[model samples]
Target: MDAVPGRKAPMASGSAPDLMYCQPCAEDGNKILPDAFCPVCKEFLCSTCARVHRNQKITKSHALQDKTSMPSSFCAESEDEKFSVTCQHHSKEFIKYYCPRHDALLCGDCVIENENHRSCMVEKILQVAKRYQEGEEYISLKTGLGQMVRDIENYILYIQVRMKSVDEENLTNINEFRKFRNEINQYLDKRENELLAEIDQTKRTSKTFLNELKTKYTNIKSATEKLQSDLHAHEANSNQLLIVGKRAIKELEDLQTALEKVSMSKDVSRYTFDRDPATERLLASETAIGRLKEGESTTTLGQQQQKQEKKQQEQRKQQESKQQQHKPTQAPSHKVNFQSSVDLSQSQFSRQPDIPMKTSGDTRNCFLSSVACLSGNRILLADYNNQSVKLILRPTWCCPRLLCQVDHGTCVNCPVTGQPSL
Candidate 1:
């Protein structure tokens, strides 16, 4: 039954085919199912598109099939299979060739009619792939890939180890700061002792002179009181009193004079403690005792590892060079005949007419430089004197035959593409 309007989206009914979204609608970012398969276009079409495909002159002849029939001859293609590359200019055609000069992938129509490729010598994709399989760039890519994987793995391991190492390094910094604080404490203790001693010396010096004066005055007062007691004792005897009074008066006069002189002496110099301004400034400032210098936050072990690795590399290079210098070449390899499993029983060696190797600009005898072989008994040769490479074709003794010599064009290695010049 057809889906009714205002109902839920269509579902597979009675196994006619499990519902699938329309390919064209999906391309346009819609999700409607109720589709049928078109083998000619190789796309699933919704009912609306199916009706259009049947009536439209361009696609009217295309037959539609059930949406599902997988595990049989016909089936819906996966995304990869449907990943066909079509030209932007020719939307319906697939790309078949690559134009190196234009540096673009093109279809047959693009090669023939596109003015961009008119002067360009286009290459077939298969021919472009000739050296791609075993080329140096491909080998280097594989090597670089493995190296990147190793570097990433080492970095991951480094991170795992660094997590713990970082904490240990932080602890080291903490301990170092505490040690610096201890050093500051020791220094302060030294300064405190010196200051305390300075105060002690000042107080001691001030007290010394005052203590001597007080002792002298105390002795004088004791002597004066004793003399008064003596004078009263002498009064009981008249003659004794008369004789002693004269001497006693004289002693009293002398003691009075000494006391007067004692009060007349100059004041003693006072000693005091004056703290250094630097001490007060030190107390006022937060960082006076300790300055915090921020070190570069880099992993020490990582740097050490880099250095060790560099050293090992240098050592390895030295060892390699030394070994290469001392190593003996294998002379047997030069003596060994070229070995091959190819059977040449049916092959014959025949003499052919010699072709001239001289060029118009040649000033010396034509000397052979190098040779390369191609398929179908063709050989390539380089003539150093003529400064040209020659392609020689011999009779195949089979269906096709060739002329004497064919000089195609000059060839140099394509550094960018790594493609061999034919």
Candidate 2:
């Protein structure tokens, strides 16, 4: 039987009018009592319509329940009183099917509207939901998420540790730099003070020496004035005049000698401050200060005096040697008695006799440059004329035997230079 428009459908005898009717049959204008409810379609179905729904390939997989056992809300008369959940795309349809290919739930309208599902495998959304709860893909996804979280946490920890270490290293470097700077500052300060002290001392010493010279020159001037006054006063007396004249001449000579002895050599007293060359180069790229050194053009006065004395001694020796070479040689007249021990302080002789030794080779024209006494009563003589050094063993003063002779060139005439002890 077909349903009439705007008319109440006649129910079976003794059946309630509020009982749900088959939705498919009602669309065809037939009023049929419902035997089953299709959850997928969200509609009541008659026994005949339910058999047709199951026979179709598209609706065969949809789940259905007995109408009498269906929920009262699902079988409500008003469309708004049906299931609460609805499809996102089709607002009026409920979500029933799941498309595995799209990984989304779909309504009956969506399945028909989208052509992508024509060849895609789709199942009930409830069945897909149940399988996902126990599937390996879901479990693996959760596991992978957990692993990512752990990895991120480890990276964070590593970064924190590295940052802490870097901070500590930076602080350590800063402290070291501070200490190094302080040390350099202190050293420079101390060196500056020392250099200043040296300069002050040099100035004071120079001034003191100048003052002494000044005082000595002033005394000399006063004495010269006195002599001039005496010469003028004694001009009338011949005896006093001769005496004053002689005294003035002597004073003038003494003044001349003093002036001759005084030397003003600027090369001997020049001073300067300089930085160490190596330290100066090092300062080009570093923070450290270069060291300062006080330099002088010449040695100290005492050192200069020592050197002068040594040169004078050498000159005196050369002069004595020349004098000895000019003297005539004579044979010994007496044989001296040899003593086991002699007191040097009491030892005295008017004339010491030279012991003559016989030599094998010609010695008359031989110019001996140097002589040295060796161990075991040996003597080394360097003969400049023959250009040879002769080593002699003198067992007795009268009988000196030549042990060996070495020939050399200009070295024979040069001063004997000392060598390291063997």
Winning candidate number (lDDT): 1
The lDDT per prediction is 0.65, 0.65
Please, what are the lDDT tens digits per residue for candidate 2 over residues 351-374? 324423335575555676775556
| lDDT tens readout by residue for model 1, 390-419 | 776733331111111123223322223222
Residue 91 error for model 1, in Å?
12
Question: Clashes in candidate 1: how many?
Answer: 0
Any residue pairs clashing in model 2, and if so which? 2-29, 2-30, 3-29
Span of ten consecutive residues with least summed lDDT in model 1? 398-407
**How many clashes show up per model?**
0, 3
